[model samples]
Target: MNETKLHDLIEKMTLEEKAAQMSQVVSSFIHKGSSDEKITGPFAGMEVANEDMTGSGSVLGATGADNLRTIQKAYLERSRLGIPLLFMADVIHGYKTVFPVPLALGCTWDPKAVEESAAIAAKESAAAGLHVTFSPMVDLVRDPRWGRVMESTGEDPYLNGVLARALVRGYQGDDLKNDQSKLAACVKHFAAYGAPEGGRDYNTVDMSRRQLMEYYLPAYEAALDEGAELVMTAFNTVEGIPATSNKWLMRDLLRKEMGFDGVLISDWGAVQEAIPHGVAADNRDAALKAVTAGLDIEMMTPCYVQHLKTLVEENVISEALLDEAVLRILKLKNKLGLFENPYRGADTELEETVMLSETHRKAARETAAKSCVLLKNEGVLPLRKSQNVALIGPFAESTDLMGPWSIFGEEKDVVSVRTGMTEKLDTEPAVEKGCDIEAVLPEQLEAAVEAAKQAEVVVLALGEHSEMSGEAGSRTNIKLPDAQLQLVAEVKKLGKPLVTVLFNGRPLDLHGVVDESNAVLEAWYPGTEAGHAVADLLFGDTNPSGKLTMSFPHNVGQVPVYYNSFNTGRPKDQIDPEDRFASKYLDAPNGPLFPFGFGLSYTTFTYSSLALSSEVMEENGTIRVSVNVQNTGAVAGEETVQMYVRDLVGEVVRPVKELKGFSKIHLEPGETKQVVFEVDEESLKYHHSDLTYTCDAGEFIVSVGPDSRNTEEGRFSYSPAGRSGQE
Candidate 1:
C-alpha cells in the first residue's frame, strides 16, 4: 500500500476504530476463544472488552507461526477495515537461538560479530512471525547497579553508538521491504533511561541538557541514523516530565531535531505511568499528553482506547494528531508488506527448520566465545585436559545460561558448563552444585571442598541467578552472593590452582573471588552455546579477546567509575599523595579495579613506534596517527588497539580522555603491524555550554594503547580555518 492508500484506510476508520489503532494489547486479549474471564496474568486487570481486542492495531508477547497465524486470521475477520495487526516482541539479543546478553556482546569489540548475532536473531524472530523487535537498546549506562544495564552496550558514547548502528543494520538489513527474514529494529529506552537515580529501575533521571547530549543521547541518534524503524520511550523522565508526555523531548528533540520520522511507541505501561509521576491528572490526561507529544502507540495500556475519542470530541486534542498516529502505524504495516500478505514471514514449516537450528547455534557459540573477557589470568587458564579438574558452583550443571529479556529462550536447550568441558577432556571432570544461588547447606560446602581437594585444579563456576539481573533486578550491593563467596573461600584453602568463571549480567565488585582465584573469567550469561564457548576458552582452542565495555569498580562505593571522567580542580594524580584535599579516596583508589578495554589473552602484545603525519591539524583536514603493535608472546592472538583523545582546554570542562577510534587486528608470534587512524576535525567536536557542537582551536593530546588506563600520549594543535602555526 502507498501513502494515498494508507490515508484512505484512515479516512474509512471510525473514531473508536482509529483510537484502537493507536493502542496495543498483550497476545492473550486477541487469541481465539479468549474472553474477559480468561484474561489472567499481567493483563488480567486490563478490563479489555472483546470489541477492543478485535480492533487493536498490534499484539505483543505472541510467538510461533501457527499461533500468530490463528490470531491474525481471527483478528482480520472481525476487523471492519481488515487492516492487519503488527506483531512485536522483546527480541533483545536473540529469539530461540539465544546469544550472549547485550552487555556481553559489547565486550567482543567486534562489530561484525555483533551484527552477525543480530542477523541470526532476526531470522529466527521473523520465522516466528514477529514484525518488530524492541532491541538494540543503546542506552549509555555508567552505573552497573541498574538491572537493565545488561541490555545496554556500555558507558562510552562512541562504542555504544558504533554497536547500535551494527545492531540496526543486522536486524533491519538494507531492504526490510524485500527481505522476509529481516525484522524492523526498534531502538529503545529512548531518552537517557540508563541514568536512573541510584541505578534503580523506573527512578527519576536529572541531568543538564549538555550532559544528556554529550553522553546519553548519542547512541540513540546513532541507531536512528542507521534507519531503525521504531523508537520506544523510556519509563523514566528526561527532566521533571515523564518521557512519554514530554513534548519538548518527544516532538522538539526526537521528531524534529533528531529527524526521527519513525513511529514512536511507549515502553510497557509508560504512558499510564505519567499519572504516578505526578505529571498527569488521570489516564485521560495521560492520553492527551502522550499523543500530542508524538507518541504513536501506547503499549499494554487502554488510556488511548478509552479516552482518545472523547478527548478528540471535546476538542481537548486535535483529530489530526490521531490521524497522524494511526497513519504512522499503518505505514509501518505496509512497509512490512503486511497488506499484500497479512501473514508475512509466518510459516509453521519455516519455524521448525529455522528456530534454534544447528547453523544458528554454531554462530551463537562463536559469538559467545568472542564475548568472554579474561579479567585476570596467572597461567592457570588454558587448562590442561590431562589434569584432574573439579568444576563446582551453582552453574556447573545448571542450564540457565540465557540471561534476562530472553522471553522465548528455553533452558532445556542450553549447554551446561560441565557438558561443554566433558566434550573436550579425555577423562570426565567431577561437577558439583556446591550451593544454591543465595543459600548454601553445610553438607554442600563440605562436598565442594572435598571435590576441590581430590582434584589438582578447581574451576569455580558461580554467579547471580538469571533473575538477579535484567529489568527490575537492581541491587544495592553489586557483589557475588555470600553463599558463593563462602564456597570460594573454602575451596581456596584446598591449595589447588583455582579458576573462577563468572556467569552474570552486570560488572561485579569482585572483592572476594578475585583475591582468592588464580584466574577470573567474566563469562556473562553466554546464551545457548554457553558450555561450548566456555569450554573452548578454558582449553587452548580460543584466546580471550573480549574487553570490558563498562568499568568494574574496586567496590560498590565507587558505583559510577568510568574511564572518561572529568578531572577535578584538585586532581588526585597531580597532587601529593599525603594531601587530604585532593580528589582521592582514603581507603580505595580513585579508579576502577579494571579499566575499560581491559582484557587478557593467552598471548601478549606490545605497542611502540608512535608517529604523527604533522604536529598541527587544520580545519576540514585530517592527521594520520600511526602506531606499531606486535605479538610479544609465543602464540598468535587478536588485539584491540584503542585510540583516545583529550582537549587540553574547552568551552566547558572536558573528560581527561575520550575514546575516538579503535581497530581489532590479528598477528602471529613476533609479528608487527602498523595501525593507522585518521584524526579528522569532526572527532574533536564537543557540546559547549550553549550546546553548540564545535571544536576549539587549541592544544590536544592523542593517546593509543591496549586499554584506557595505560597509554602513550603525544601532543598536537588544532588550528581553525586560517590559522597556520602550532600553539
Candidate 2:
C-alpha cells in the first residue's frame, strides 16, 4: 500500500470499523496435545471473541507450533476484510529458545547478546505468524518488587538506552518491511511506568518532572530514537493523571518533545479504566480522551469499539485525530507488507524452519551464560572436580525455569542447573531436595542434612517460583519466599561450606544467606540453558562476570534505595561524629546491601592512579581520565570499569555521586590495560527549573571503580563550558 492507497482505505472506513482496529483480544486456542486451554492474560480478563477479520491471525502460544498455525488460519479465514489481522504476543526473551528475562539480560551488560536474543525471538515469533511483539520493554526499573521489573532493562538509564536501541534494531532490523526474520518491536509504557510507587504493579506514580526525565524516561526515548513503530502507554497514572489519557505525556512529552513519530498504544484496557481513574465519566469519555491525547491504539481496551463512534458523532473527538491514528496503523501494515501480502509471515515452510533452531538455542545459551552474576565465591566453585558435591533444592533439577512474563515459554526445554552440574562434575554429586520452599517436612529435613553432610560442599539452589515475582507478583517483603531461609539454615547446620545459587526474578533480601553462605550467585532466572550457564559458572568453564544492574536492599523497607542519594544538612558527620545527627541510620545502613555497579570476577583486579588530560576544561575541550586496570588474579577475568562524577559545589544540593560511564573488559592473568573515559560538559548536565538541561561552570570529581564504595578519584573544572547537544 502506497500513500494514496492507504489514504483511500482510511477514508473508506466507518467509525465503527476504524474503532475495531484499535484494541486487540486475547484468545486461547486448543493445544495440539492437550484439551485444556492455556490461561494467559492480565488478570485473565479477555472477551470470548471468536471472530477475527484480519488474516495474519490469532495466536495459541501454549498450544505449540502446530496448533498455533491452526488457530491462526482459523482467524485469517474467518476474516471478511481479508486484511490479515496481526498476531501480537509477548516475545520478551525467546519464542521457544528461552533466554533470561530482560532484567537478567541487563546484568550481562551485553548489548550484542541482547540484540542476538531479540533476533532469535523474532525468528520464532515470525514462524508463529507473530507480526508484532509487545516486548523489549525498556522501562528503567530501580525497584524490583514490581513483578514486571523482571521484564525491563534494569535501572541504569545509559544501559537501558543502549539495550533498548539494540533490541529494537534486532527485532525489526535495518529494513523491517521485507525482513521475514523480523517482528515489529513495541516499546512499552511510553512514559515513566517503571517507577511504580513502592515498586508495586499498577500503583500511581507521582514523580517530579526532573526525576522522571532524569531517571525513568530515557529508555522510552531511546526506543523511539531507534525508530520503534509502536509505543504502549502504561496502566498506571503519571503524576495524578492516567497515562493513557495524559495529553501532556502522550502528545507533548512523547511526541512533540521526544519527536516520536509512531503509533501510541494503551497497555491492555487502560483507556476504559481511565473512568475508574476518575479522569472520565464513562467508556465514551475515556475513548474520546485517549484518542485526543494521541493514543493511536487501545490494545486490549475494548471500550474503543463500544464508544468511539458515539464520541466521534458528538464531536468529542475530531475526525482528523481518528484519521491520524488509523493511518498510523495502516502505515505499519504497509511497512509489514500486510496490505499486499497479508500472509507474509504465515508460511508453513518457514514456521517449520525457524522455531527453536539450533542457532537460536546457541544464542539463548550465550545470553544465559552472560546473565549469570556471581554474587559471592570462595573458590568452592569449579566443584574441585573429584570431590563430592550436593546440589540440593527444588529448582536444582526441577525444570520450571523460565523467568517472568514467559507467556509462551516451554519448561521442558529449560536447561536445569542440576543437568549442567552433573555434566560438568567429574563425579555425580548427590542431588536432593531440601524441605520444599512452599512445604516443610520433618523427613525432608533429614534428607537435606544427609545430602549436605555427605558432600565436601553444598550448592544450595533456591528462589521464588515463576509466579512469585513480576506483574501481580508484588509483595511487601522481597525476601526469599517459601521460607527457603529455613532450608538454608538447616543445610548450613551440616557444618559444610555452602554456595547458594538463586533464581528469583526480582531483588531479594538475603541477609541470612549472605551472612551464612560461603558463596552466592544471583542468577535471575537464566532462560533455556539456565542450568548449563549456572553449571558453567560453578565449574569455572565460564567465570561469572556479570554485575548488579539494580541495587540489592538489605530490606524492602529501604524502598527506592539507590546509589545516588543526596546528603541531608546533617552531612556524613557534622557537629557530632559519634551522634545520631549526622546521617547515621537508627537501625539501618542508609545504604543498599550491595551497591549498584558492583560485581566480582573469578580473578581480582587492581586500579591505578587516575590520570586526567586536563584539570580545567573550556567550552570545547575534552578531558580524558585514564586508569591502569591490572588483572592481579591467576586466571583470566572480566571487570566493569565504573566511572562516577560528583558536583562538588552546586547552587542546588547534588547527589553524593552519579554514574557517568562504564566499560566491560576482559583480561588474562597479569595483563594490564589502561581504561579511559572521555568527560565533557555532558557528564555534568542537569535540568533547571526553566525545563532546560545545562551544565554549570564548576568543579567536578570523577571516580573509576569496580564498585561505588571503592574508586580511583580525579578532579576537573568546567568554565563557561556550555553544552550544545541533546541530553
Candidate 3:
C-alpha cells in the first residue's frame, strides 16, 4: 500500500479502533474460543474487551503456519479496516536449528559466520510464520554478574558494533519486501540496559552523559546505521527516568539526534513498569508519558487499549500523536508486504523441510566448532581414536545444550557429547554420569574415579546448568558448584591426563578447573550440533580458532575487569610491588586470568617485522601499519591479528589500549603472511567532555599482537590543522 492509501485508511478509523491498533496481545488472547472467555493468569489485571482482541494490530509468541493462518483470517474478518496483524517473537539466537549463545558467537570473531547463522535463523523463523524478531541485542556489558551478559556480544564497543551490523544485515537483507525468508530486525534494550548497578538485572543505571555517549550508545548507533526497522526500550531507568517514558532519551536523542524514524516499541510491560519505577502514578499516567515520549506500540499491556482513546478525546494528548504512532506501525506492516499478502511466507510444507534440515545443522556445526576457545593445553588434546577415553559428568548424555531464550528449540533434536565421541572413536569411549549438575553421591564418585583409572585419558564435561545464565539469572559467586569441584578433586587423585570441556553461558573464574586439568576448552553451550562440533575439535578434524570477547576475572571480587579500561593516576603496573597506596590488589593481580582476544591453538604463531608507512598522520591522511605473522609450529592453524591504539596524552584520561581493528588469517606450517591495517584521523576520534566526536593532535602508541596483554609496539604522531604541538 502507498502512503496515500495508508493515510486514507487511518482517517476512516474510529477512536476505539485506533487505540486497539496500538495494543498488542499474546496469541492465546486471539485464538479460537477466546472471545467469550475471561482473561486470567498473568493477564488477569488487564482490562480488555473482545473487540479489542479482534482489532489488535500485532500478536506476540505465536508460531506455526497453520495456527497463524487461522488467527490472521479470523482477525482480518473482524477488523473494521481489515489491517493485517504482525507476528513477532523472541527469536534471539535461532528458531529450531539453534546456534551457540550470543556470547560464544562473539568469541568466534568471525562476522561472516555470525551473519550466516543469523540468516539461517531468519529462514527458519519466517517459515514458521514470524514477521519480526527481537534480536541483535547490542548492549555493551562489562559485568558478568549481570545475567543478560550472555545475550550481548561482548565488552568492546567496536566489536559489539561490528557484530551488530552483521546481525541486522542477516535478519533484514537488502530487500525486505522481496525476500520472504528475512525478518525485520529489532535492536533492543534501547539505551544502556547493560550497566545495571551491582550487576543485577533491571537495577538502577546511573552514569554521566559523557559515559553514556562514549561507551553505551555506539553499538545502538551502529545498528541504526545498518537500517534496523525497529527499536525496543530498555526495562531499566536512564538518569532516574524510565527509558520507556523519558522524552529526552526517546524523542530528543533516539529520534532527533540518532535519526531513527522507525517504530519504537516497549520491552515487555515496560510502559506500566514506570509506576513501579516511581515515575508514573497509574496505568493512565504511564500511557500518557509513554506516548508523549514517542513510543509506538504497547506490548503485553492494556495502557494503550484502555486509556489512549480517552486521553485523545479529552485533549490531554493530541490526536495527531496517536495517528502518527499508528501510521508508523502500519508502515512497517506494509514494508513486510503483509498488506498485500497477510500470510506472507506462511507455509506448513516449508516449515517441515526447513526447520532442522541437514543444511542448517551443517552450518550450526561449523559455527559451533569455530566458537570453542582453547584456554589451556598440555599436549593432551587431539586424542587418537585408539586411545581409551572416559567421558564423565552431567552433560555426557544430557541434551540440554540450547541455552536460555531459545523458546522454540526441542531437546530431542539436540546432539549429545557421548553420541559425538562414540561416532568419532574406533571404539566407543566409556561414558558415566559422574554427578548431577548440583549434587554428587559417594557411589557416583567411586564409579567415575574407577572409569578414570581404567582409561588412558579423561574428558570431564562439567559446568552450570542452562538456567544459570541469561535474563534474571544473576549470581554473586561465579565459581563452579561445590559438588562439581569435589568431583574434580576426587578424580584428580588418579592423576590421569585430564581435558576439561566446559559448557557454560558466561565467562567464569576457572580457579579449580584451570589449575587441575591438562587441557581446558571453553565450549559455551554449543547448540543443535554441539556433540558433532566438540568431536571435530577433540579428534583433530578442525582447529580451535575462537578467542574470548569478554575477560575472565581471577575471582568474583574483580567483577568488572576489561581490557579497555581507563588508566588511573596511580596505575597498578607503574608502581612498585611494595607501594600500598597505588591501585593494586593486595592478594591478587590487577588483571584478568584470560584477557580479551585471548585464545590458544595447537600450533603457535609469532609476530615480527613491524613496519609503519609514516611516523606522523595528518588530517584526512591515512597511515599503513603492517606486521608479519608466521605459523612457527608443526601444524597449520588460523590466527586473529589484533590492532590497538593508545593515546599518550589527552584532554581527559584515556584507556591504556583500545582495540581498533583485527584480521583473521589462515596459514599452513612455516607459512608467513603480512597483514596491513589503515589508520586515519577518524580512527582515533573520541567523545570529548562537550560531546564532540573528534580526534586530538598528539602522540599515539600503535600495538599489534595476538591478545591485549602481550603485543609489539610502535609510536606515531597525529598532526591535524590548528593544533599546536605533538605531546
Candidate 4:
C-alpha cells in the first residue's frame, strides 16, 4: 500500500483503534500458551483480556509458524478494520538454529561472517512468522558485570558501528517488503543503556553529553544509518530524563539529528515504569510524556491503550501526536504488506523445512568456529586425533550449549563435546561428568581425575551455565566458579597436557584457568553446532582467528578497564617508579587479563616495517599507512591486522590509542602480504569540548599490530586548513 491508501486507512480508524495501534502485548494476551511454555519473566497478573488484545497492532514473544498463523487468523477475524497484527520477538542471537552470542561473533572481527549469522537468523525466524527481531543490539559495552554485554558486539565504537551495520544488512536484507526470508531489524536500547552505573542492569547512567555522544552513541547511529526499521528506547535515563520520555533524545536527537524516521518503540514495560523513575505521576502521565516524547509503540503495557485517547481528549496531549504515532505504526504494517497477507511468512511447511535445516546448521557451524577465540596456546591446541583425549566436564555430554535468548533452540538437539569428538577422532575418547558448573562434589571430582589420569591429554570443558550471562544475568564476580576452578586444579595435578575449552556468554576472568591449562579456548556458548565447531578448531580443521572485542579485566576491581582509556595528568608511564601517587593499581596491573583485540592463534604471524606515505597531510588529504604481515609458522592461518591511531594533543582528553582500521587476511605458510589503510580527514575527527566534530593540526601516531597491546608504530602529522595550532 502506498502513502495515500495508508492515510485513507488511518482516516477510517477510530480513536480507540488508533490507540490500539500504539499498544503491544505478549502472545499470551491474544492466544494463551503461545509464549507461556517458557515464560521466565514476571507476568502473572499482566494479562490483557482477549477482547482487548484483538485490536492490538503488534504482539511480542510470539513465535512458530503454526502458532502465529492461528493467532493472526483469530486476530484479523475479530478486527473491525482488518488491520493485520505485527509479530515481533526477541530473536537476539539466533532462532531455532542458534548461533554464537553477539559478543563471540564480534571476536571474529569478520563482519561478513557476522552478517551471515544475522542473515541465517533472519531466514529462520521470518519463516516462523516473526516480522521484527529486537536484535543486533549495538550497545557499546565495556563492563562484563553487566550481563547483557553478551548481546552487544563490544567496547570499541568503531567496531560496534561496523558490526551494527552488518547485522542490519543481514536482517533487513535488500528488500524487507518483498522478501519472505527477511525480518525488519530493530536496533535496541536506544541511547546509552550499556553504561549503567556500577555495571548494573537498568541502573542510573550519568555521563557528560559529550561522553555520551563520543563513546556511546555511535553504534546506535550506525544502526540507524543502515536503515534499521525500528529503534527501541533504553531502560535507563539519559541526562536526567528517561530515554522513553526524553523528548530531546527521542525527537531532537534520534529523529532530527540522527535522521532516523523509523518507528520508535519502548522497551518492555519501560513506558509504564516511567512512574517508578519519578518522571511521571501515573500511567496516564506516562502515556502523555511518552507519546509527546515521540515513542510510537508501548510494548507489553496498557498505559497507551488506557490513557492515550483520554489524554488526547483532555488536551493534555495533542491529537496530532497520536496521529503521527499511529501513522508511523500503520505505515510500518503497510510496508510489511501485513494488510494484504496477515500471515506474511507463517508457512508451517516452510518453517519445518527451514528450521534447523542442514544448510543452516552448516553455516552455524562455520560461523561458530570463526567466533571462538583462542586466548592461550602453548603448542597443545589443534590436538592430534592420535592422542588419547579425555573429554571431561558437565558440558561433555550435556546439551545446554545454547546460551540465553535462544527461545526456540532446543537443548536436546544440541551436540555435546563428547558427541563432536567421537565424530572427529579415530577412537572415541573416555568421558566423565566432571564437577557441576557451579558446585563440586567429591565423587564427581574423583571420577574426572581418574579419567584425566588415563588419557594422554585432557580436554576440560567448563563455563557458566546457560543462565549466567544475559538479560538480568549480571554478576559481581566475573571469574570461573569455584567448582570449575577446582576441577581445573585437580586435572592439572594429573601431570597431563590440559586444554580448557570454555563455554560462556560474557568475557570471564581466566586468571586461574589460564595458568593451569596449556591451552585455553574461549568458545563462548557456541550454538547448535557447538560441538562440531569446537572439534574443528581443536583438530586444525579450522584455524582460530577470533579476537576479543571486549577487554577482560584482571579482577573485578578493574571492572571498566579497556584499551582506549584516556591517559591521566599523572600518567602511569611517566610516574616515578617508587612513588605511590601515580594512577597505578596497588595490587593489580593497570591492564586487562586479555586486552581488546587480543587473541592467540595456533600459528604465528609477524608484523614489520610500519610505514607512512607522508610526514604531513593537509585538510581533505588522505594518508596511507602500510604494514607487512607474514605467516612465520608452518601452517595456514588467518590474521586480523589492526590499525590504531593516537592523537598527540587535542582540545579534549583523548584515548592513548583508538582502533582506526582492521583487515583480516588468510595466509599460507611462508606467505607475506602488505596491508594498507587510508586515513582521511574523518579518521582524524573527534568530539571537541563544545561537542563539535573536527580535527586539529597536530602530530599523530599510527600503530599496526596483531592486538592492541603490542604494535609497530609510525608518526605523522595531520593539519586541517584554517584550523588553529595545537593547544
Off by over 4 Å in 2: 27-82, 573-576, 721-727
Tens digits of per-residue lDDT, candidate 2, 432-508, equal 88767678777877888888888899998899888888778887878875557888888888779899999888888
The candidate 4 region of ten consecutive residues with least summed lDDT is 42-51
- Model 3: CA > 4 A from native: 33-52, 725-727
For each candidate, what TM-score against the reference?
0.98, 0.94, 0.98, 0.98
Clash totals in order: 0, 9, 0, 0
- Which model scores highest in lDDT? 1
> How would you encode candidate 4's per-residue C-alpha lDDT over 138-168 as one tens digit per residue?
9999899999998999999999999999999
Q: lDDT for every model?
A: 0.90, 0.78, 0.90, 0.88
Q: How large is the C-alpha RMSD of every model relative to the true structure?
A: 2.1, 3.1, 2.2, 1.5
Q: Can you list the residue pairs that collide in candidate 2? A: 54-85, 55-84, 55-85, 56-84, 147-470, 147-471, 148-471, 416-531, 417-531
lDDT score at residue 435, model 1, on the 0-100 scale: 95
lDDT of 3: 0.90
Model 2 root mean square deviation, Cα atoms: 3.1
Per-residue error (Å), model 4, residue 616: 0.6
Clashing pairs in 3: none
Give the runs in model 1 whose Cα sits over 4 Å from its true position: 33-51, 722-727
lDDT for 347 in candidate 4 is: 83
Better of 2 and 4 by lDDT: 4
